[model samples]
Target: MSPSLSIATTVSPASLAGTLVSNSKNVLCSLHWKNNDATKTNRNLKFRVCSVSGGYNTSVENVPFPRDYVELISQAKEAVELAMKDEKQLMEIEFPTSGLASVPGDGEGATEMTGSINMIREFCDRLLAPEKARTTRIFFPEANEVKFAQNTVFGGTYFKLDYLTKPSLFEDFGFFERVKMADRVKPEDELFLVAYPYFNVNEMLVVEELYKEAVVNTERKLIIFNGELDRIRSGYYPKFFYPKLAALTKTLLPKMETVYYIHNFKGQKGGVLFRCYPGPWQVLRRTRNKYICVHQQESMPSLKEVALDILASA
Candidate 1:
């Protein structure tokens, strides 16, 4: 018999509040701007207000503006606009379902979600814009061809690109080696994109190194194309891996500016995006045991909801 599946969208008010409080205390501090008639003149203030109220954790105090306050506000506005535009594109894309018809944990279905390639392309295009060019970095461990194709299509300077022939997480690299690797990440690199991180999640030390880089370098954003949640829940992964991944996510949540968990579920028509904040630890714990069967539509969350949540947080 197939394992039972159910849509997971039961976030209580308490959970939302917890997330907001956590975000306000940790991530959204630098984005906060003093309210004034000058702010009223800024077109992006509305976006800032929505971000703060919805869950960004920005403060609305009467602090004085900095010397280059205008420039700062302009940069923030651009970031907000870029994030909004990207979120919209993510929602409208017709997420191809050709490869998602099989049941989870089935031999090929677990590793062959080729349909997500389109989504990754879209993400790469958006993140490679000239405005985001310098600060956006993408690491693709498995898809060198895709990266090369994107470089050909989008130009070589679109974003900083790196590929690992072997999964860094699985390699026998020690902590210092990992740290040395992490040191290559420039402080200006704000966005970190990891495409189709499959078995890499099992490499806890490598994952730790990545998160440690984010912590040491603040304002870093993590966007992961993770399709392994269902596989983990189905017991394809070792029992210890789930807890370790969850713990790492929790530990990093309080440090990184944003951690977007973009998942494409099998048998679902669209992708589901999650903002891992406040209580990603709790969320991951709940998701670890849930088996999403082919027939369980109600058990899965919709892509639209996930997109909206991302916009609100942005």
Candidate 2:
């Protein structure tokens, strides 16, 4: 059964507006900015991002993260667990589905958007406490992706798999019926995990709306799991073409704490860009079974710069 036909129901624009207006009023009432420094450092994230000396231990065995797929999921889970321990409401966890051989860019990695389904399920199962497991709602890019995930990766409706967009007859022409955030979230829900929302550029704008309408002033927390935001960060989606998504680099993304991340570069100067919550971003080179950190910075470095400049010199 196709996800569009089987799962998605028609939603009238008037009904969507009614629900959105109701939620928008509530969100607006509580909307206010937190102190900049407080938003960045108030959480006191568990991972201590400290200065790394030149002789810092960089062995892969000594490194806490995993290299293989199964273990990588665990590492991602741990990173989120640490982020959960912090006070940050918006967080992100991103990595390559293709074993870190390449960056998680569109049309490059090994079906990362699709492959992220199982990883989200496994890690969420491990990361969420038993009591909080059922309270987390997982949102996918489309209803079809939700149906596909339920059958394949989820193995029969383990968690609530919802979707950001509903396909329309004009979907191939870049049109979709967007579900309102107010209609999707329930009062019982405590967490919202959006899985690979990068499939459509508008999906991310919906995410920003979801944050503003549902999560901003509530006890709820949200995680952008593998949204491949680097596409926006790297300007792959030109601002002139995708102004909303491009603006996210400043608006929604700055508010997010990247709890876990890994992007790889393949070349003679190939290296990995890695960071865990509270840890400084590190540029690492694989050595046999281990990794050696050649550079570390408090802020994330550009993948191009790392691949071309930093690693080239290191």
Candidate 3:
């Protein structure tokens, strides 16, 4: 299943775009403004970026890679190991699956996902010796394209950021405010470290702060997968901005190795940046051709007083 982030609010899409661009400008302006209000309010996230290797490597070779990147990779690796002895098993791939149609247009997500998938297909060709990697297209997202690589170990990672902290938290930290899981994350809990396209890559201080949070906080091991360096290239990974991010994450989060996971685009086991389209087709699914899916009538909530059966502890 493909998933993505939701950027919605009460404002119309057009207006939201305008507002975000304006806000982005405002945020940029604050970085230079000496005025405390302007400087303090800036959400410039440049400094929190850093340089590291890009793409897949032995270090990231895991099975069924973790859920998403981490989980999926682990699963892939496990699948690889289990199939090592079975040549027929490795060859049981369906090639056309990964070649399915993607959502049209310049959507960053779609392109990125497609690019990643293409790279993955290529990776399978190299690492698995024809027996393992196979691509196929399954109908999902209302009949869009999906690349399914069998036997290709999934060992990469992608991270989800808690952009705005909880409301009513600290005097300075009250944007989207509360951070509920940093403390609970453990070494065994899979982590996807992705350097996203959402942050400002020019600000150094902000990068430093993010770096600290990942590095000093807990005892669990975490991977700050540098999607930035891998996808975008190094012309802008660290120019006072990137390193601060890597550095700060190291400081703030406890017990972690802030190493870079670079992608190899060349050699046999090189890396690639693929993008898949979790296109608008998904939204279009509601209107199937000739067959309209009538969503059943909505059910109203009933607060009935049911018996409270408490099972005794075993």
Candidate 4:
């Protein structure tokens, strides 16, 4: 199917996974480095997968098989748990749902989007106990996805599935009405997970509203899962067009902790900006089968600086 899709990533060797860019019927099974030569240094990585329809015959013994997405989700779940344990009420976990080669917020293509949905489901399974699941609310970008999740990833779970926005008839052309959190949030809900709010600009604004109304000055905690808040931080949406979104960089963002993050920069001098809570920010470059930290700092570095300076220099 589709010539067995392959892509590159800057994720660490232990958790390397390429973007699975097919429909829901396809499954990404097994990943192996294309370059087996130990002496030849490889800058870019190639991830190969077998689709479910492809019989899943590919095998890699000794080396981990099919742990790509699992490892990433596991690490992300740990980061979120650490953030909550540290008393962080507002937190973020941003990574490319697609492979590292793809830009975040451009669009979460169907394959990667489903990957994220499944990742969220597995993440919650590992993150919350059965009793805790009943008190947690998970918000999707729109009402339609909530229905999908109810039957798929979150099936049989008492955890609530809600939405941030509702699409109007003109939604296909980038128009959607924001859903108010006042009517959606329950008093029993102790935690909220907002998933992929960057689909529509209004979604994140609604997220800010959720924080102010339900999360603030309370024991409740909020985690933005794959929201792609960097679009606002990097000024991708012009301040003139999205002033409220731009304001979040100064207001809501500073209070939030990025518990886990992975942003890849691709070019002649390619590298990944990686961070996991309680760990320092790191700039990593791929050399053959391994990733070496080129630079690291305590504070988060701007994406622009990471691309132009850190990656360029490293």
- Top lDDT hit: 4
Candidate numbers sorted by TM-score from highest down: 2, 4, 1, 3
Per residue, candidate 1 scores C-alpha lDDT tens digits across 161-265 of 653234346356521222233655777877665554454554333544665555344655555454343343344556574676556434643332322332443
- Evaluate all candidate structures by whole-model CA lDDT and list the values in order: 0.37, 0.69, 0.24, 0.73
In candidate 3, position 132 carries an lDDT of 22
List, residue by residue over 4-49, the lDDT tens digit for candidate 3: 2122223222211111111211110011111122121212111111
Q: How close is every model to the real structure, measured as TM-score?
A: 0.41, 0.77, 0.24, 0.76
lDDT of 4 by residue, 1-314 (tens): 43343343345463454334333332322233443323212122222322223433222111122124555666677667777889999999877776644565456466666767887887888788889998999999998889888878788889989999998989789999888899999989999999888778999899999999999999999999888788889999999988998999999999999988888777789877877776667677755555555665668999999898888876
lDDT by residue for model 2 over 114-224, one digit each (tens)?
668768877776677767767889998899888788778776544777999999899889899889989988888988999988777889999999999998888889999
Clashing pairs in 1: 6-299, 7-298, 7-299, 7-300, 24-57
- The number of clashing residue pairs in model 3 is 96
- Backbone N/Cα/C clashes per model: 5, 0, 96, 0
Error of 3 at 314 (Å): 64
Q: By TM-score, is 1 or 2 better? A: 2
Give stretches of model 1 more than 4 Å off: 1-117, 142-157, 164-180, 201-205, 215-217, 230-236, 240-314
Error of model 2, residue 128, in angstroms: 1.7
Q: Against the hidden true structure, what lDDT does model 3 obtain? A: 0.24
